[model samples]
Target: MVLYKTPNLKTILLNVFQDGILPYDIEDVLSLLVQKHYLMNKEQFLNYYKNDINQFWRDVASLGFKRDEKKATAESNDINDLKEYPEDNDNDFNIDDFFDSDEFKKRSDAEDIDNDAFKRNVSLIKDYQGINNSNERKNEKLNDICKINQRLVEKIAGKYEKMVRGTCLNIDDLIAFGNHGLLKAIDKFVPDMGYQFSTYATWWIRQSITRGIADESRVIRLPVHLHEKIMKIKNEERQYENEFGAIDASELCKNINMSDDEYWRFKSIAYQFDQITHLETIVGTEGDTELQDLLPITITVGSKSVPPDYMLTPEELFEKKELHDELENTLECLTSREAEVIKLRFAINKPDTMTLEEVGEIFHVTRERIRQIEAKALRKLRHPSKSKKLKDFIKG
Candidate 1:
């Protein structure tokens, strides 16, 4: 990546002008250098130029080390040393006019000009004239096409405006994006390809509009791969539903060739597009409770009946104490390792429980071996001899 520093636009433009670069050629060079080589978009380049034309030129100049070195050398020269070219003062000035002048004829006759130098100069003049004529004809053709197709451009832009109506972008923004696509199509489309202009332009127009929406419309932007997958899945689902009625989850997963976990994770992300809601949104005709206030609270045995508060009742507190004691007594009947495994697995002393794999790791045993030990310990506790100790609690 090239890290560019802004250059002096006046100095850069002066150097380019001194080198006899045409305005149209300068524009082409700027577009190619900024968009292709520097990795900047057209809009960003335009904005930079609009802000400061001189600064824009300077920055563009910085892209070339040779240009900057030349500029530095020129800047170091004395003002009296710099000479202006005749072309700088007059657009109509021609080399042919210089050759046709009486002063030039007098000098040539007196100096005895070399035949080779005269032939070379004449060839150079012809080449310049040919290039200038070709450019003029090209400009005229482009202008005529643009003038004739202005209405067609507007129509295409309007169509895309309607298509992307509900996006974060307004109709004007969509139309602007569509117009850019249309302009690019005009520049690239070939009549020899045997396709209608509209047919070729449609893809570019829709691509530009949809890309804008996909990149800008969402509150939370998804990764491009995920977004494409979600869109593909949606399209497939619609096709399947139309042809085969309601689709099964397993069949849908198979069609997409995704595992259960992957499919569900994608489904959850896709569903978020519809699930977004504001906290202050009213839910019912009553118009009293907001969505946030209506969110469900899990109701336990002694949970509060009054809004936003909770406390344990006497009876529930006593029942919980009894249950704790019975659990401890039952655990005591098992071997130490068995008891420890059971407690960790069930989260008896912690808010989160350990998995079978975690318990196996702690005891340096296979998961299946830990399962066997737990089952055996449970069987021993459930035997008639051990059952008598907790018979009352079991009855309750």
Candidate 2:
């Protein structure tokens, strides 16, 4: 008789990676088995999975291992199928703009996806309820309609591109807003209204673009209703000025049917719209000072208060440069991958430092592996030859 015993989680993990199999390939699969009580003991796991690594990976691939391939395929198909379109009656349709709007180059790269791998991903995603027929059909229909009318959205969005330039928005942002509006139009559209769908969609698309600008282009976002009121007030003022010259605040308020308090309140809010200037804007006549430099900072020297001096003295700046160069030279001692890991871990040339798990995900490795790499890199950096200059710089 053969002896049988239940093995712990650690034993299973060790067995899974013992064959040089990536932890990513089997970690989730093992977790699922444990969580679902699929395997009662080590003997069963070894009998079913440990002996057949190929079958184990197929099971993982079926569970949507890393990426949801179905969604990517659907998106790629939507972009590809855009070439099949109805007759264009409008002469204003520029093929270049249409291609630019849809980002054809980016979408075409999706065609190069490995068929075998895609099939594996799709098979797994299907089993997980991640992509189903009903949802897929609905998405296909939505994408088709969006692509068909994409030219209309692009045309409307193009009109606002220059207007929103230098604000927190660009042409691409406007096009996204237009696409959102197109989707909304598709949902609420009544075909029996005896109006062209393009005409109806144009209103919604323009509304969406304007709303996006109002919501996003400002440092402080204002309510959409407030923005509408502001626009109404401005239109009234423009019309009133054209008919009768130079209307004061009280007169303007009466003309717009707003009370004095409301007019003053609106004016106060509107003033901020004009005050939007980037901190990077040059201020001094010599163009050496940014607007941020004018911001006040208090420094205490003895008992007296003084503004903090941001300008570095020649010697101090040279020392800082020397220290930075030395650090770079020390980092060069490490292998390229190790240097990149250290740089990313410490937020060097990056917006923020990443956690070991996040770094691992980027490199397609496990968190423990990333930890090992980080520790190894740190050990090298801590060596006397590497540490001595860094320590002196810190002390100085």
Candidate 3:
């Protein structure tokens, strides 16, 4: 429901020129004019302006404005000038030699003046009251321009403040953030870029306001980049649902070009911000059991019960005993080393089975040697004589 209005081109130009001089490069100003007013880029503007550049300059000229013919020619010949200063290939060439050359010496000598002494002499000139008065007038004009700009910034910020109502941040804070963005936009804006300043500044303003909300409104703060990504994912989800019938996780991942790990990680963080059940909320069918009552009570380490769920039931216990007796009789058929290895590997008494490496360390043999013996013992157990002893148990 928010309505955003873009400032007119004349308003932008008036604000820029109120200081009575162009603050940006001449090329930049021309480029902006070509884009915003003439609907052309720099190249096209140059072609069209070539014939009337002098007249154009005269129309825009103000105090201290003067054309630099030499500078303009140098700019036009920039590529050719680069060719004149080609890199020296010789590693032994002394760079200092160029600085000591006649051309460099002539340039330095022509510009050699004691800057401090010149300033001191100028300060001693009491007859130049007119110059001091002119400088004071310039300062006053600059102050007036600053006041006008300040008022404009406030007006723009006020509009944005209303848009962010009901957010955790107060109106004043929103305005302050918006004003900061406005100042930055003003500093970097190129009016001739075929766009209104309002359009550019609005983006900055909205970004600042939204960032403030993300930072202040969350119980657990997330990085700005993560928050922005979460918002983008939610928006994409809504768009996908509207276009397609249902959401497919793999398809969404492909569309966003995100890995499964990254998508799930962001989703988990976003879910933390959603509303959760309170401990006092009723959870059971009887309506008497609260959520907190259903939670397991924490027990101290010494008071913790040895989990009985893993213990064998009566029938299972009886079956296990019969199997153990059969295994013991069958193990007797193996060699002494093989019997020991089988018992240790299966953890007949110990809490956990021993690895081949552990059995090797105990018997003073390599793990490969232990493995070979175990394999040989298993082959022997599968013999007709030994197999017949356990055939009934296996069939049952």
TM, every model: 0.33, 0.34, 0.30
* Residue lDDT tens for model 3, 145-173: 23333444454445545433543556677
Q: What is the lDDT for 390 in model 3?
A: 75
Per-model RMSD to reference: 21.6, 27.8, 24.2
Screening candidate 3 with a backbone cut-off below 3 angstroms (N, C-alpha, C), the clashing residue pairs are 32-192
Question: Which digits, one per residue and each the tens of the lDDT, describe model 2 over residues 10-105?
Answer: 344335444433343234444645555545544566575546544444443343333112211211122113232222221222322322243322
lDDT of 1 at 338: 90
Model 3 deviation from the true structure expressed as Cα RMSD, one decimal place: 24.2
Clashing pairs in 1: 7-58, 7-59, 9-54
Ranking by lDDT: 2, 1, 3
Among all candidates shown, the one with the greatest lDDT: 2
What lDDT tens digits, residue by residue, belong to model 1 across residues 1-396?
A: 321333454444444445533232235556655643452655565564563433443344344322211211111111112122222121222222222223221222112323333333223322432444578765655555444444544555565454344445677777666666655555544433222344344444544555555555565776545766666666666776677666555566788797646655665566554233444588899998566444432222121112211223344457667877877888888989999888887777654578889899999999999899888888988888767756765543
The C-alpha stretches of model 2 lying farther than 4 A from their native spots are: 1-140, 158-166, 188-196, 240-245, 278-396
What overall lDDT goes with each candidate model?
0.51, 0.57, 0.50
